[model samples]
Target chain A: MITLFGVGCLVFLVVCALVVARTRDLLAATVVFAAYSLVMALVWQQLQSPDVAITEAALGAGITSLLFLLAIGRTRRTEDEEG
Target chain B: MRHVPALLLLLMVAYVLFLTMAEAPAFGVVDVPSRNLVVDRYLDPDPEETGVPNAVARIIFDYRAHDTLGEATVLFVAVGAAAAVLVGRPGPFATRPVTGTDDPILRTVARLVIPFVQVYAVYVITHGHVSPGGGFAGGTILGGSFVLYLFVFGPGRAARKLSPARGEMVEGLTALWYILVGLGGLLLGASFLANAAAGFPLGVPGKLLSGGAIWLIGLGIGLKVAATVANLFLHLAGES
Candidate 1:
């Protein structure tokens, strides 16, 4: 059951990564990248690396997302080009 | 064009992950090398030799003190580079001009959350001996609270609380403190960062006031890192 859950998380991570890469809208891509980090953190937790998991949660999910959001707020998104 | 290279990079990363998975040990199985070299020494530390409550702290501030110093230097350099690039050539409009409506709900939520975040950050820093978190982790949390404030209150407000000059001063002084500690060891006819040989008093184990130089080193690192990261974000926000 745990293995199944890990696999599910891995799949979600892959999907989120793909979404982040393929999406042209910068805001959407940033949000998807944040999701990717979150899922990756869960995968680390499943691997029983609580230390790495906590670091990932702090860095990957928290700081990276905050940085991305700040960048997005400063720059114009793809959709904003039409305006 | 950009997408092609990105996709190729992703493919490479996936391939590496697959290879790692293939060669990986079973879940919860400790690797032999780590078990023998690192874990063994820490778990059954020589009680007669180095009396420290946290083995990890002992390793960080004693055995691997030079590495910690180097890591702190890296943070200092990063913060300096970030400031140089972001703040040195700031235009007349570099100041973050507030242009948005201040939502009362958002402000209230931030006011509520900031205190808890600060408390948690302090807890993580002080309890590094008993928990998985240490200086770097706790420092990042503390830095994050400032980042949260920056997002809600704008860069100008955050800068008032954490000025660039003060941040730089703290970072520089922390680096100096680390070096001075190492020098103290050297002056004692021991190698740099020689915690045991330097005659640092190893107080009662498992207490907050114990761990000799380790606790002080952790505090130094925590303060330096928190200031460094906060300054980086502040400079970036100021530039934008």
Candidate 2:
């Protein structure tokens, strides 16, 4: 059962990574990246590393996401199209 | 196509990484080389040796405290570099406060949630020795609350609560406190950051005060990290 859950988490993580990579809108990618961090935190917890899970949730998902949002607020929201 | 060679290179790198992963230790296996005697030495010695039930905390705060100190120094230097870069760079919104969101619901929710978030951060820091959290996790949460406040209420009000000068003072003081705690071990005829081996009181395990210098060092790190993180956000947001 736990293995199934871990597999699900891993799948979700891969999906998030792919979405973040494909998204050209900086804001959308940041949000997807935050989701990736949150799911990664759950994976850490499943691996019995709650210390890492807590840090990942707080720093990875929360703080980094906020930082990205703030940076986005300052800069352009979309990636520039290549010539 | 222009991208064909790039794709082939990517596939080649991926195959190499896959081979490397196959050669690595299996997931969660007990007989893995990573699960060496070091793990046993960290866990087998009861709380008497380390003064904490949480083996993670014991390892970080007691056994390998010097590394943690280095980590703290790195955080301090990173924040300093950020402050150096951001401060006095006259962007239009650099000095003054960026007006906060005027949304009533967001403001109301922030008012309601900030206190709980801060309280939980304190809990994570204080209870680090007994639980899964430690200074880093808790300190980030604490800074996160301040960041949320800055988001909802604007830098003007947030700075009034914790001005940049005050934040610098707190950061420096907490860092000095960590060094002082480490020096205590040396003063008491032991190596730097030594806990029970330094002849300090370990107290009863499972208690809040059980870990001798571990709890103290954790507290210092918590405050220092909190200050550093908050200051970083404030600087990056053009307030500091």
Residue-by-residue lDDT tens digits, candidate 1, B1-240: 769999999999999999989887775667744467556666665533455655666667777888889889888888887776777676543544333239898888988999998898888777665555667778888889888888888877888888889888989998898888788878988787777677877666666666656767887887887898788888777623
Share of native interface contacts present in candidate 1:
0.28
- C-alpha lDDT score of every prediction, in listed order: 0.75, 0.89
Find the 10 residues in a row with the least total lDDT in model 1 chain B: B92-101
Instruction: Give residue A21's lDDT in candidate 1 (0 to 100).
Output: 68
**Which runs in model 1 stand beyond 4 Å of their true positions?**
A79-83, B1-35, B43-56, B91-101
Residue A38 lDDT in model 1? 80
| DockQ of the candidate models in sequence | 0.40, 0.60
TM-scores for the candidates: 0.83, 0.96
* CAPRI class of candidate 1: acceptable
- CAPRI band of model 2? medium
The deviation in Å at residue B236 for candidate 2 is: 1.1
